[model samples]
Target: MGYNTFHTEGDMEVEVEVEEADQSASSGMAKQAVVENVALANALVKDGGYSWTSPSSLKLYPIIMLITLNTAMNGYDGSLMSSMNAMPAFHDYFNVGKQGPATGLLFAIYTVGQLIGSLFAAPAADRLGRRFGMCSGAFFIVIGTIIQATSKDIGQFMGGRFLIGFGVTVGCTSGPIYVVEVSPPSMRGLFGGLYYSFGYCAGALVASWTCYGTGKMLGDWSWRIPVIIQAFPAAIIFCTVWLLPESPRWQIANGQREKARSFFVEYHGNGNEDSAIVNLQMEEIERETNYDKELANNRWWDYRPLFSTRDRCFRMYLLILVGVFNKFVGGAVISYYLPVILDNIGIKSANEQLLINALNVVFSSVASVFGCFYVDKFGRRNLYLWGALLTGLCYIPMNVIAALAEGHVAKGTGYAFVAFIYLYGIFFSFCWMPLQTLYPAEILPNDIRAQGFAFQELMNGLASFINTYATPIALQRIGWRTYTIFLVLHFIYLGMLWWSIVETKGRSLEELEEIFSDPHPVKKSLEKHKIVLATGQGVKRKPSSNVNDDGFGNGCLNPRNKESLEKHKIVLATGQQSKWE
Candidate 1:
């Protein structure tokens, strides 16, 4: 193997040769935190070396943004279809009604691809590595875009949509997990939320505007323009993803601890091997790496560990809710069929409908940005509850307005309905856009993250399929009454938001054990997090007080109450035979 070298703070800039870990690790040894001053742990982080604007952070953020943009692949597709609903040229060329089985199939086929693509999502993410999943997914989307844009017939168009769906699922399946894996623990919420808040919205923004710009044209180019535009984000990702680093946690899991340590030292520790920031991360990764061995015997294909316990079951419930709610609560309907919905309310000019859709994307993007930055500021549950309530309540007013405006150009009611839509869009994007992937990625154990997401995407694909297929049919048959279903979802989702969404703000990935292990996760998640930091040598520090200990203060990051060396005993016994490949 080729060697790369870096200094470890000697007098001279000595370049020590380090073996490159292009693949898995097999070492049985483990590293522990170095901080020995337990009392001085809380003050260890000086604002100086860990500046967010440091060169280390600058080099890191762009790679994350590139991988995260895979989300835009689907967002762009949705924008294209919704914009097409308002385009006469697309309907005329395709020879299909704006709201019927034909239109439903056209829109829903993308989700069919997602469902099928989901089958391989775990394999790609777990075995091939994040870069592989990202690069391959991007390739599929680009190819799918080519087929769809140049298609001569409906069958051709459907084939393209299927490929796009499959590609995006494979692509997106790794993105959130990878982003969360690499993000700074304190800023995990911000970076993770940006996966959708920025990437998905950026895709939506481009597509909506591209549609508006092309809709003014005279030929088949109007719809084809935006369809082709869907290729850009994935293309960019495909080209740049190989330059991205492998996840440090994945490196450790594979036993490349030295390589993982080097990354933490250079990027996270800022040339120092023992920065508090790097130490904390190493502490978390090492502990989780231990538990991951317990799961090593279970082949990558076995998913039983995801639901092997009651806590795991609650996590499964939360995953299902995130997946289903992402699409079912009227969001997907608005996303893919907004033009159709607007047409029903006397917004007759196709141009006017397209304009409204474009503006809504812009408006929602602003809310998404706000949500992204403040995700850690406002606890996940708080924002979700408020958004669910506000957006859900808007549906009732919208249903009432649509009911009053149907069959006649009641300009007043039509405008009122549009206003309500803007309201719903803003609030919905504020919470859901950021939380959809961020919450699930953080809650799931590293061992089962791929399996957990495989399950979540299944639920996501099912809900999306139901909405994409049923909404237009329901809208056509029942007119305004179709929204009543979402009103019901709104209520149920609001209750679940209050009961289920755990606040993960300011907690490390390994630290979340305290939250999930307690019977009352919501309550447990809310408590202030405590952790014992090691300087250079201690394996574990017994908490000074046992009566008030909540696991956070127990100097050990392990979920179990064992010293660090004891944990490595399990890894040593199983590490060699428990290979993923």
Candidate 2:
């Protein structure tokens, strides 16, 4: 076959050529990180590089915004519930008499709902398409909100909260996958991470201020209004999801080639079906998916690869650690216990507590917006390493000041502690909030992304449950020492990250698969990342001059070995060849 040279109207031409050669090297050779990176790079980028301001990017931005907006349900539910725990009317109406632990239990039960939702999130996303998965989740949230708004007893209140938790988990988990799968390589960090930053934080911001306003209302409406308001975000997602396109990657994997092609043309290439960019992406998806089927047999239960070898197992731990540390890193403690903490420190006014909560989330939301713009620019390793380091440092002075003013409230120390609290939120917004959702999505392969992401959600739920349930009790007992536990844990987390996690900036989703496949992915990744960042180009393999090209000229970018392609074809043909066999 001859090389195909495809070009867009305002873009440069890209040539894809095929040639025949001896397949000895690739025949017995296993797929590794460096080789995979080369193949993936060939698939994602065209000769004419697509930037953030291109026509395709402009067309795709609004669609990405819609998907990301689903995360608001998560943010709104969390902040609203945290604020409600501080409401005096809420305690009286729900009969939650003077027990602090009882409020903590309510929070813990909500996490249980999240646990249940996460259990089913993987199957739903894999069985149904991404669009339908999100819609199903939003529907659940709407039902849960309705149940909560009219509940008169603790049982009904908890049932409603559980349902909201379940629904939000599904939507939140699905939102990141959709953004990551659909985003262009250059814009992946910004668009893939925008949901956690803009959607979730925006939801929290609205909830915080909404609870403050509703607290002034006379009766049940004080708490019931915010509960009812929770339905709107889920409702918006449910209504609009059917109108959007399915993930192009998902479409290709499920064997919907023509449909996938049309989507890439319309949504990604702005209707330029012949665009070299579209052709390259489609080729990459088909080849990589075919290769994955050969490697893992396309079965969901084959989780052995995740923990079979040292490198793979290490990567799994890193993913789980991200989910765990994100919750336990002191932000959740401060978020749910802020009003209580403030009261103990002499800011005892209920109105002042609500106002502080409102301002904290509002400022945190602004920081998230800023984070979205800078995440790609900063790289994942730097963002996590520095963000964790800086935020952890802020806690030392904060704890010292709180201890100094423990019994008799010093206004200056109290205000100093408040500033530190806000500063902590600012650092967390920049570091964890955006990455919590983005990191796992980037690290996991497409074959196991659904399952891996689900696992992380499970970890996140458990961690959140413990922090929510235990933070109140811990603060009641140790006071400022509650801050000390996280201070130590933060450094431990930073050390683990430094030793293990690799930078995944300026690389496509497919390129990440190669990084994980390498035996020494952490080191190999650092080397590959440097090349991509320095040149704004993907890592390229050294060209062999000895290969003969029968169908394409010397200038054509051809696959080196025809025998390797034949071997790959044979491997694909062996449908159920399990490693265990």
Best by lDDT: 1
Q: Which residue window of length 10 is worst by lDDT in model 1? A: 567-576
Encode model 1's per-residue lDDT on 130-235: one tens digit a residue: 7788888899999999999999999999999999999999898888889998876756788899987888888888989989999999999988888888888898
TM-score of predicted structure 1: 0.85
For candidate 2, the lDDT comes to 0.70
Give lDDT tens digits, candidate 2, residues 1-581: 34343232224322222233123223322121121123223333332345455677777878887786678888888789778877889988877732268878887888899899988787678778788779888999999999999998988989998998888788777788988888766567777668788988988988999999998888899999999999997898899988888888888878898998888777666576665447656765776788767666455545565665554576679887778876777888778778777877778677888888899998888887888777766778888888889889998887787677678987666777889999999998977778878888888777677777877788888988999988888887788888888888888888988887887875666655555565667765565210010012222222332212211111112312122211111110011111110
What is candidate 1's CA lDDT for residue 559?
Answer: 56
For model 2, the run of ten residues with the poorest summed lDDT: 566-575
After superposition of all CA atoms, the RMSD between model 2 and the true structure is: 9.3
Question: What are the root-mean-square deviations of the candidates from the true structure over C-alphas?
Answer: 10.9, 9.3
TM-score on alpha carbons, each prediction: 0.85, 0.84
The candidate that achieves the highest TM-score relative to the unseen native structure:
1
